[model samples]
Target chain A: MSKFKKKTATSQEIPTSALPDIIFMLLFFFMVTTVLRETEIKVEQTLPKATQLRKLEKKSLVSHLYIGKPKQPEVYGTEPKIQANDVFINPDDVVLWVNQEKDKLFEDERDQITISLKVDVETKMGIISDVQQELREANARKILYASIKSVDRE
Target chain B: MARSKRGEAGVNSAPMADIAFLLLIFFLVTTTIATNKGLMLQLPPKPDPNQPPPDINKNKRNIFTVLVNSQDRLLVEEQPLNDVTELRSMVKDFVLNFGKPDADSRALYNSLPNSMKSQVLRDPNSSDHPGEAVVSFKTDRGTSYEMYTAVLDELQGAYYEIYGDRVGISADEFRDLDRKNPEDLAKYEEAREGIPMAISIAEPSKVGGE
Candidate 1:
């Protein structure tokens, strides 16, 4: 009969001594992996879609070149402009910009630096070719035509 | 008499977990994983301003011209192709045209899937081997970015498919091959040792917007 009685001799609550440690582990993970937004993205972007794509592994070795309509059409005009960092510069300025980017990196990493062209889907290839021409002039030939993943095969 | 003999109770740590959870939830909500991936391409080196452009005479069979007009229409090998998906098979067939099947050529033929093996449509007038084949992708200024990427995707996919077949893995696995892993790096180098992807992007036709 005594065996059938309620067993409240010890605390029924789960031992939560490791709860803080577990939470802290997850907290550190989030802290370490977080990459805060650096660029303001002055231009309006709608990335094109593609199926076969390679992930850009090293963030330090990439120069982002944005080609899209200005977010405020009235101020910057409707024409799709080229944005490198903060300013929307002319196509010819790409040489200076690319060279500056190359200069910022270490000597060994300079040659391997890739230019990522994040262009709008609606954008015409005319301005894009202009940027490409400037890229050639800059001798920064390695390019990654940035795109989102697509469902369709094409 | 100077000191009280009463025992002190333990401080509560229940609120500490709650605080950590709040911060975790904030980061989870605010932080976005950067999804930066794309089709890689390499442009030709800048031509010397002082010297004349060297006009190397390439065999007509070796050059595969794909023209994308301002209207987003595709002209593949001078033939109008409506579907971009068809480019994959066309490119594979063109790349693997090993004329005069020897030991090396026979081995290449075996790498292709059983489905593709059934179609004996090798062009004698086209490229002799993967080494000589060049796919020249030409676009018009007015061509939309979507169409250009769509076409480029199909072209690159063909090469990746071939590489995956040679290494006995799927195309997705081939793309995800990390150099950090020795086995993966070996597989990658083995698959693409001689058959380099030589898709050249020619100058675009100046037609549209600034």
Candidate 2:
């Protein structure tokens, strides 16, 4: 009976050391396998007010396009040519730039593409229409326009 | 030698380590990196607050309006375009003729400048007028995700054809335009910069058929 008890004790001791190593390896494995979320561009666009707003799914691929006042061209001299600085054009240029970037980002057909257009409230319809025209030209089919939910002025 | 032969009743520690290492390697090999996708539309830099706002309303009439309702219908000035191809051609004509010196007949300008020659020639500073199309799209609020994207795709395809043709490179060759000569690359980049893809929204009217 004494010999039987001694044999059982030795068997338990072997597993004790192995248990901690297994747990540690598992923890490390999970840490390494975990995927981190990606960062996206943050810009303000006026979203239309809605009574119901749907939450997007976790894996949805959404591309962003923002339209606002055109930034002044970089000034070089003390007295920069104000004419160059003052010239404001449509958002078509920005769209073109975005399309080129999108082409590079989504080279694989397996990945889904979504375009979110964020336009300022006061911007004319013509500018947005031109953007849509450009999107069609670029073969970017999925599009979402962001608008602020309207509030009653009263 | 007699003691070594006495007992062999336990699993070896080395084998346990080997198993742990194998499991670790399996997990490492099986893990996949998550990826995101979509059309990367470049936004214009913000306007300097000190500068006065441009008069967009004054030129609204000159600008063509293409509405993509929540239903994904394409309308030009309230009239539906025949198809995506027609819309593209119409927009190409409009953008190409925007600031020409000839003032009298704007509509006739579309026919005068035969599209074949014009599509192949691109000005380095002419992103705004890529093949004569300047279109603005207003999407309704209740539009479905699929419809909105389809409309956007059609519009982008048109622009792509115009820009692609003007650059005088096939899609296959143009794909590597970035990796080509520095001057050609700069020309491509310059032509691409500052273009707009602005989309606006209005209070969605309960229109029929999405």
> lDDT winner among the candidates?
1
- Tens digit of per-residue lDDT, candidate 2, span A45-109: 33333211222232335555555433332433221111111232244554455455566564774
Residue A120 lDDT in candidate 2: 46
Q: In model 1, how large is the Cα lDDT of residue B205?
A: 87
Candidate 2 versus the native: TM-score? 0.39
Interface DockQ of each model: 0.68, 0.04
Candidate 1, residue A81: Cα displacement in angstroms equals 1.7
**Candidate 1 segments exceeding 4 Å error:** A1-19, A151-154, B1-9, B99-120, B180-182
What is the C-alpha lDDT profile of model 1 across B1-210, one tens digit per residue?
Answer: 435466556688888999999888888876777767998898889889899999968888878889999999999999999998899988888887764455765676677567546653567788867777899999999998888888888989999988887778878789989977899999999888667898988888876533
lDDT score for residue B179 of model 2:
32
lDDT for position A65 in model 1? 93
Give the fraction of native contacts in model 2: 0.03
TM-score of every model versus the real structure: 0.86, 0.39
- At residue B105, what lDDT does model 1 achieve? 58
